[model samples]
Target: MRTDSGLRLEADPRPPRALPPVPSAIQGDTPLSRPKKKKPRTKNTLGSASSEGLAQAPVHRPSEGSELPAKEPAEHPEEAPIQRRQRKTRLPLELETSFTQKKASNSSLLRNENGIHVEPPEEAVTQKPRRKTKKTQPAEIQYANELGVEDEDIITDEQSSPEQQSIFTAPTGISQPVGKVFVEKSRRFQAADRSELIKTTENAEVFVDVKLSWTTRDVALTVHRAFRMIGLFSHGFLAGCAVWNIVFIYVLAGDQLSNLSNLLQQYKTLAYPFQSLLYLLLALSTVSTFDRIDFAKTSVAIRNFLALDPTALASFLYFTALTLSLSQQMTSDRIHLYTPSSVNGSLWAAGVEEQVLQPWIVVNLVVALLVGLSWLFLSYWPGMDLSEELMFSSDVEEYPEKDKGLKASS
Candidate 1:
């Protein structure tokens, strides 16, 4: 194809071009086309040579559609040479055997038959024995025994024969009652004959022939004296009152006893003293007989004394007077004449007087009755004899004498 320009643009001549044929040698010498050189084989280099051979060998790659079996690497021959070298440099046989034996023994010790580990028991070490010493007795008991300061002679069972041992034997006095019976019968007859004659005696005295120490009898005698004084005072006071009443009858126109109120007013002061004396007498009488009285013989006399004694009669008289005074004070208007100042002071004072007088009467009466009952009970109540309780003797041998005296008295 030409353009429209006049110049004739003839078509340029074309030439066919071709590349020279590649030289066969040069083509064969290319990396992809050349054949590899085979390594030289020798005993010392065989291992390395084989390894190179294996690396140069064709690898079988699996296609996308098929799976191929995995290949394992072959063992290298160099391993044997390395093992031989290590063996040549290892420790001696004896050292190796010792190490192995130690390891085996340790394992055996650590693991039991059941595979459980446990601690070993502690070893016990023996020690030398020690000597013992004797113990001494207390000094106080030893001294007392050596000095013969003990209260009674301690006769051992080996020293005293059966006949000589009085520990379990009954007293001789208690065993023989014929003499005691005769004495009691004779005493009863004498008492009967002398009863009327002795009734008028001021003191009702009983004599005991037992040999008692002064120390044992002191308290009893003191109490007896006190009771005697109290009885004397009581009798004296009664006598004085009687004399006063007579004197008053002659002096005051004898009008004091003409009325109940007058008599109570005059005798109120004496009532308390009489009651006190009665109580004191009862106490003294009870205490005096505590150890001296033989209950079996004196039970009846003691009962009579408590029931019909002069002290009891006086207590009853005073109690009656107090009761009469209280009744008159409550019912009679003449009571104000006795203590007008107190009556006019306050209503409370009047009430207090009554309250005080009532309790006084009740207390005195109750106390008197309790004292009498206590004495009676102590004298006659079975198994309640106070003689044994009140005795102050410490010697066991003296008890036989006391028993004899008690038997004679009974």
Candidate 2:
């Protein structure tokens, strides 16, 4: 381009210098270059000025990869006390950072007194072991032969061998029959001992069946004794009366005695048998009263005499005889008292007075008295001593002490 001075201002005509050749190593290593140096971190001073500044200033977040400086002690001694008071009053930046980190780390981050970093305590975790179970075996069929027979019978045909049979039959010491026999003998011995104990108890004298020992013989003997006493008294009296009657008849009318005798003879056929029976009964009663008769034999005699009551029979015969004699004396004109005077004759005819007692009447009165006495004795008569007769032994025990006392007394 031309200037006003008319000189040609030619552009520098030097060819663009050729650029130098780049090194390949430097181009290849460009991506692997070192990182840029970071600026030095600012430290948080724990002083009253910094604390006051931090309280007034808004909180600011640090960029990534930036480190906060450690806290430095106060420089001035006079400010140290005020710095500590401020530190106590206001929260520190490091403490706030640590708390934020703890929250972000889910409480895993911890801080110590000098703001040292700490890790959370480790927890032990246990895992349970799996259990193993054993498989169940199949059920077996039990047959009746398997229940009662030997083990040899339990095996299958394939297992039935001579060795198995020998193993089962080897024990010869245990004998079931011998053991059963011993048990049976033991039971029998125990039973015999028990029976002996029972027998001993039975043989011990106890007075239960006391009345069973009372035999009819004892009752018969007692009755016989009572009757014998009565008969002895009554017979002697009656015999005396009969003798007196015979004498009186002889004195009153000796000629009439034959008639009276004939009259007695007429009734003798009937009277003699009854009279003999009465005498035989009286004799038997007397014999029984005196003799020690066997009670067993007495029971047999009582059974035989069950058909007749001896006391009633004897009384009936005596009364009948008396009645016949009284009738004969009253009806017959032969048996009477003899009166020679007319007054006596009139007295006899009037039947108002009696000089002598009638023999028949005397006999009847004696018999009546005997019957009355016999009845009275029977009414008061004590029966058999059943307690004594039946008792096998006294209720009192025969102790050795009693016997010793008796011997000492003797």
Q: What TM-score should be assigned to candidate 2?
A: 0.21
Instruction: Write one digit per residue (lDDT tens) for candidate 1, span 263-361.
Output: 345645655454444444443343434322433346643663577643333433443433433443432333223453355653334334444434443
Assess the local accuracy of residue 374 in candidate 1 as a C-alpha lDDT between 0 and 100.
40
Query: What TM-score against the true fold does each predicted structure earn?
Result: 0.22, 0.21
Global lDDT scores for all candidate models? 0.32, 0.31
- Over 4 Å off, model 1: 1-213, 242-410
Q: How big is the positional error of residue 13 in model 2, measured in Å on the Cα after superposition?
A: 99
Across 1-410, the per-residue lDDT of candidate 2 in tens digits comes to 11111110010110111011222332222212211110111121222334343442322112100211111112243533343333222222222222222234333212332233343222100000000000111111111111122221122322223332345333223212111111136446322243343344444422323445665656765675576566556544554544454454345433634343333324334333433443444344333222211223455334423634343333333444444444444422322332322544432342322222245434534544543443333234223222233232242344667888999999
Q: Residue 88 lDDT in model 1?
A: 19
lDDT of 1: 0.32
Q: How many residue pairs clash in each candidate?
A: 0, 1
RMSD of candidate 1 to true structure, Å: 52.2
- What residue pairs clash in candidate 1, if any at all? none
| Model 1 error, position 323 (Å) | 8.0
